[model samples]
Target: MSEKILNLYLVIDNGIIEEFRACSYEVAGSDEEKISFLKKNAANDFLSSFKFDPPVSNSGKKMKYKQFSRLEKQGKQFLLFEEIFQKFQVPDSPLICLTPVVDGEILSSN
Candidate 1:
């Protein structure tokens, strides 16, 4: 039997952010499609309410590059919530509020 792996990711840009729940099943063979569906729907849902591109990335590069960046497309690297908060130094500011994100899930079978 083949092993299964799951990954959850988030993206933020231009003051807009999105969270996604992703899963992969060895029998399903639909991880890419699932991630794409979630991202597309999430993007469409937020488009009317916010100005930002959907979170999409290819997490399988040796050098770790953004997969969706093209001449006609805009893409960015996905980071964890703490990474974003640390990079932006939101913790030092008293006025900034940081919320805990425990929505990540990974189910693997080997």
Candidate 2:
């Protein structure tokens, strides 16, 4: 058998969503404070579409590269959370919060 992770992540700038690629995000996790932060900036539907589709570990993480490629119709490397975080980390920027992410799903099999 094989293991497929259904988890996904997002890049939250302050509270605003970077993009509404819900089809590009598959939800499940993110911090409550961050979620609350996002609530202040984004619409509720945007949050729900989290049933959209997208990140980083060998842990319970997912891949934005594949979904992003599929959604944006392009083949490029998925930006790591660290790189994305740096852009929004000017001290003036509130915070760059990510749900949680891995490079891809399907970690391993037996």
Candidate 3:
């Protein structure tokens, strides 16, 4: 089956898209569950930049590591940040990477 997605209409801010999106997965659906999933994934991605060590012999020292409890807490907080953005819609800032999509996938950024 094809993957689902969240259709978010966001107001651009600064130079960002000002929308909900997952790191690797596409945001699918307009419901709270989908939005929350996107936020959670984004937070995980944001927190993934702080890894410094490898967990096991096979596992490499990838940036996306959840090592500490504090990191988990930070991830949760990052997910909640969407509320702030939703409350204050961004002003008329130019969208840099806005691209058209024929199917569920994005066409291109250029």
Q: Identify the candidate with maximal lDDT.
A: 2
Supply candidate 2's per-residue lDDT for 30: 44
lDDT per residue as tens, model 2, 54-96: 2434784554444544644552333433343333232222232
TM-score versus the correct structure, for each prediction: 0.20, 0.22, 0.21
lDDT of 1: 0.31
Clashes of each: 0, 16, 5
List the candidates ranked by TM-score, beginning with the highest: 2, 3, 1
Compare candidates 2 and 3 on TM-score and give the better one: 2
Number of the top-ranking candidate, with TM-score as the measure: 2
Give residue 52's error in model 2 in angstroms: 17
Instruction: Point out the worst 10-residue segment of candidate 2 by lDDT.
Output: 101-110
- Cα RMSD (Å) between model 3 and the true structure? 15.8
Error of 1 at 94 (Å): 30
lDDT of 3 by residue, 1-110 (tens): 21343222222233222233322234344455554664444333432322112122245332222232244466442332244333333222211121222223443322
**Candidate 2: where are CA atoms >4 Å away?**
1-35, 44-79, 90-110
